[model samples]
Target: MKLQESTMHQNELINLNEYLLTKGFELSEEEIAKLVHVQKEICKNLKWIELDESKLYKIILPYTLSPYLSFDNKMITLENAILIYYKIRSMFDWHLDDETCITTCFKTYTSLYGIQDKELIKTIIIGLKKEGYNNNANDFNESF
Candidate 1:
């Protein structure tokens, strides 16, 4: 799938930004663009290839933010953003970086955060189902 196709719409993105504001995070448009870019980059780069664990962490770290900060230059990686979103909101841990894991994390975060726009969540759940994460997909249906 194309990157933008699987990403949030502009208004949904704004909702996300607004949600973040409630958590004391206010990402600028530029930062949000960078986040979208980085997520696309990671997905494109890792689509058919697996990185070693350390390399994967290295690749993912720049996108992570310090949790204590209200604002910073560092942007959250899509994976870590999902992880942190769940962590902060529900105390859930989403630690894996594989495609299914990331997609599920995204679905969970969006659902729990009240994103409400079902297109992205449906897409992510479909992707998970295709990957044989039927249980996970069912959980999303139940939870969201």
Candidate 2:
């Protein structure tokens, strides 16, 4: 679903939470509200032309999973994760290039978050690459 510049309604926020649940994120109501607010703020600040449900999910996915992500025995806090996610989103808005944005996100995470686990970083990069390829393929198919 597309979300314009208007404020999200209660039912729409509930639907967004339900959608996140289907994607394996069981966020609380408060968390869902925060995510919606964050998305709106980002779009407003960046002057994004469009804000879709899929884009919101992609933007907040890392932040949602941040609590479970650890590197070198150090846990990534939600606050830090949110910052990283925002940076990545902003980069995407500026560049409109997935590879560059993803790479910059990885680098920023490693440097600022002190992620010292090389193997973990490698796995994350591989996953991002695979996802990128799949998204490209899907975009190609949908364009036809």
Task: Identify the leading candidate in terms of TM-score.
Answer: 2
lDDT of 1 by residue, 44-97 (tens): 543523233223333322233233324442353344553332322222224334
Model 2 agreement with the true structure over 16-126: per-residue lDDT tens digits: 455546546555667655755765665676576443454544443443333334332212233333334443444222323644444545454554454424343334434
* Candidate 2 clash figure, as a count: 0
lDDT of 1: 0.43
How does model 2 fare in lDDT?
0.44
Winning candidate number (lDDT): 2
Off by over 4 Å in 1: 1-8, 48-69, 77-79, 82-144
Model 1 CA lDDT for position 39: 48
